[model samples]
Target: MPRNAAQTEIYDALGVGFGPSNLALAIALSEQPERLRTRYLERTRQFGWHRDMLIDDATMQVSFLKDLVTPRNPVSRHSFVAYLHQARRFHSFVNQKTLFPTRIEFHKYLEWAASDFEHLVRYGQTVTEIGAWQDQGAVTAWAVTATGPDGELSTTLTRNLVVATGLTPSLPAGVRTSRRIWHSSSFLSNLRDWQPPDRPRIAVIGAGQSAAEITAHLYKQHEAAEIYSVYSRYGYTQSDDSPYANQVFDPQAVDDFYYADQQTKQSLYRYHANTNYSAVDQDLIEELYRRQYSDTVSGRERLRVVNLAKISQVREIGDKVRIELSSPHLDGPLDVDLAIFATGYRPMDTDGILAPVLSHCDLGEDGRPLIGRDYRIATRPHVTAAIYLQGGTEASHGISSSLLSNTATRAGEIADSLTRTGRAATTLPVSVPQE
Candidate 1:
């Protein structure tokens, strides 16, 4: 690649990240009749979606029909069924009679879909900055810079920008992770590297699906060890997947959510929080309870459910960590060999990347970026460069903003917006958008 951007090469759109959000956008762009030159930058060496947490038996919560393109264009070759058929497993999959496929299988389907756009993505390049591309006094495009594979800077210009950098792993305040401590995002990898002693003490914090899954996995893997499931709740809450309640993810619901007042939106979130929050599947909860009860019946209870508890403090003492566990049932602190936090993730803050160009964008009353119904950031009239968000729109777009449930439809909407914006500004500069 070149050190300096080619003066004549201005992309119609540039995607900052190549995760499922942008991947769906790529597919939509490619399938659209009016093509706009587009490229995606990803920091990873290859495409992967939650690689470390693809537990063998874990199935996707969302249905296979929600694959990258099926909801928007059922005939697309990138659909999950198409992948299964191309991989010669369609008949076998049909025999299973399940709407959700294994997470591993779905990830492979994503890779299969991604393979078609290998030529359009720049892997191992992390975006570092997005600045205004000015012509005279008008900000006409975005000047994007990224750290190349070898640490060199590669800059490019684009008329339209889509940021889908995804979320950041969240940890409670004052809690830090070490070799023995980990967040659920890298659970499998860390566990693989861990060499546990005989009858080790392991604690998993949080009451989410990840925490429950880790509890089950650890119980299975470490038969002789003590596995503690510590959480504030008295027991695990079952996720709400009932048919009527599931309408929260419908495309029309997004419109309802968007138009609702702020108070109504908050109420909606509170009402539907069980759908995708700190909850576990009912089947898994039953399985865990069965295991716990069986151990109790055998007089060899290795799995301990420390309910209504919170970890007050954690300190490393050589190989093991001393956890200051506070609970109504506990008499003292509990120490563990390893601790895993499945506290979930927070939306990635893009202030750093958008710093240079943010002043030109409008803000809501709460002082955050004011994103419109089309997912475009509200900007001043003089600014012609369009910027869109592919994730972190939950506050404005509803619960499915950052989920796979509405990814295909959302992508199609963004792609439609980009195409219309492109057609309206046909007089803008054009060249091959590449390094």
Candidate 2:
């Protein structure tokens, strides 16, 4: 670590978020022989990825082989198996013989990998603006502006900017979160130490894995409360995780998807949407079904499955939320003491920070940035600063853009691009101090 809080005159790469994607990039940069001055800014005071939803018994959707380092460098010490070995749990974990580990354990694995790059990370910094750095009538670097914990603004200069700010929580149109309503992103935290009344009616909206998991969790936690899982679909659709279908997430598939015609790309995304979007794991679906069946056998069922139903309107009436249903099975608006929306997440929008720099970027017909296979946004020829993305590239890349399935390999590719761009050389008017 540096003896003082000294920043290099210009960073070779400055990452916007300290999440898994950028964390993998940091590891890749470190492992390479070339020394690229890099730094990561995280809005959180400490490192955490979906901490609120790190359910104890919940397993990862992706295989453990797709860890932060394995997909890029299987022999890297930063691998999850390496962490398990160092933590003295490798043998025990092997005995379980499961490809997916608990979400809690996976989060710990991520934190373990992140611990190695503390010197290159500055927490509690939220990036606000990004712009081209103009000096001597030429653009040389990107000026990244961010706000500190105390609300003071600071700017950093870097030749390359990798934005991996992650996804945004999405809710249904016209629905807002309140005391009685909340999204699954805040699931565990919102229900911490809180208990519903006896025979309380609860409405869980959406048909994704989160919705099923939350339903199962609530059923186990509050035995007396009635868990009503309301969704537009008649039943939860199982995700397509077959080996053949899983090929869509392969590293090579990204290249194939990128080069394919627009019609082919749309067809592929539409056909494989069930693999991730609005789908639940097969085992979890069976578990929920079994619970509902067992409860039905007992004659007093607390787990209610309200299928083919949609909440047309949600109104907060004092202590309860009255949700108007559109299905034929409903007699009137169901009044529930609590309603949780497991509505998934939206892709990261670059418009916020990229406003000042958008003029240099080429936008697609949809007004989205035109990104290359390297994940670098296509910019005007004069703009030398490279802008790479770790998320929101499903249009050009594939479905794995914002997912952990390809993060490790994706980061390695981006790191390779950084090296090939001639930005890895720490050369400037002022010498960069060696570690």
Candidate 3:
């Protein structure tokens, strides 16, 4: 049934963050705005994804085949190919003869996607909290607290909410970052301002691709610098990008993952988690290894891989960072001048805000939401409106939650569900002014 125009309350299905996950959602809604009443809220003034880590030589982990819209609907006007054409760089891209686009190119593609639905996004706004309106047993409306531009606070009422608050980077528990110590996520942003004499020793911590990339980058940038790469693993694990293993990321995999029982889902995650983390691209691994071998033969020893080692402590003294490395297998402790933690990110928890409403929603034994196949948080007898999830759906929806493979498809599915199952009144009240 269509909503009544006489309803005075403002209706919206808000998106909490504007990363690629929710940007895909915005695009999906823009393509069919009449159906889904939605608005996107972003903390930043504009769309960005790990901009501080946008290293020039870095490339996307996935291929162009896994763009925002292609897998689900190749002919859609919002495909990366269409963005390239719109930017008038199709021919130039063709000359590159590379199936994978650079990190810069992918970031630009994300910006293009965000721009396609500028009307739906509220930048420079942070969603601080979400509360539910109780009418009998069901959740009638969602109360959203957002801090807008000019330091003003506002509240908007919505029928449904999509939480896409993305991941936050994590360093080792004890390590403290300062002017000298830094994480790889902020490497590019902070590196330019950091000045040091030539032939300095720098230590990069981790066996992942980012650590290797940063090592190579610093090596190339500083001709006489010595790089010490440390990792708990004996060697970098190679990613499984073979045709058959890669099929695990196909669109159909979502069905397989969704239908699988808890144990099966765990098995799948354990089996394929290497595709993203704890692994390095085969080509990159080979190249870094080759560089290490060349350095050994030349007797320069510029690149040192301290395998089975971990940084025990990091202390910053003015412009230099002192890193203490330890390993049970090694006899003595080794100290380095700088330490870079290439560790990854953790999911953003809505607990602080959602704590008041936790009893209304269904939760798993682990205290996480029991997300349905459509990415909606499972609620109790109460809470009629949907609370969709984007990034933190991995526990219920599988590995595609934080991944780039199923973003467009996920957004389209969510939009379809919202339009077909629920209705929101977009008409303004007779007494209220329309914007």
RMSD of each: 2.2, 3.4, 4.1
Distance (Å) between predicted and true CA of 300, model 3? 2.1
All candidates: TM-score: 0.96, 0.95, 0.90
Q: How close is candidate 2 to the true structure, as a TM-score?
A: 0.95
lDDT-superior candidate, 1 or 2: 1
Model 1 compared with the native: what TM-score? 0.96
TM-score of 3: 0.90
- Top model by lDDT, which number? 1
* Per-candidate local distance difference test: 0.89, 0.88, 0.77
Give a tens-digit lDDT track for model 3, residues 253-299: 88899899899999999988888786888888888889889998999
Worst 10 residues of 3 by lDDT: 425-434
Worst 10 residues of 2 by lDDT: 424-433
Model 3: pairs clashing at backbone N, Cα or C within 3 Å: 139-383
Distance from true position, residue 301, model 2, in Å? 1.4
Q: Report the C-alpha displacement of residue 2, candidate 2, in angstroms.
A: 22
lDDT tens readout by residue for model 1, 21-94: 99999999999999898889999999999998898788899999998999999999899999999999999999
Candidate 2: residue pairs that collide: none
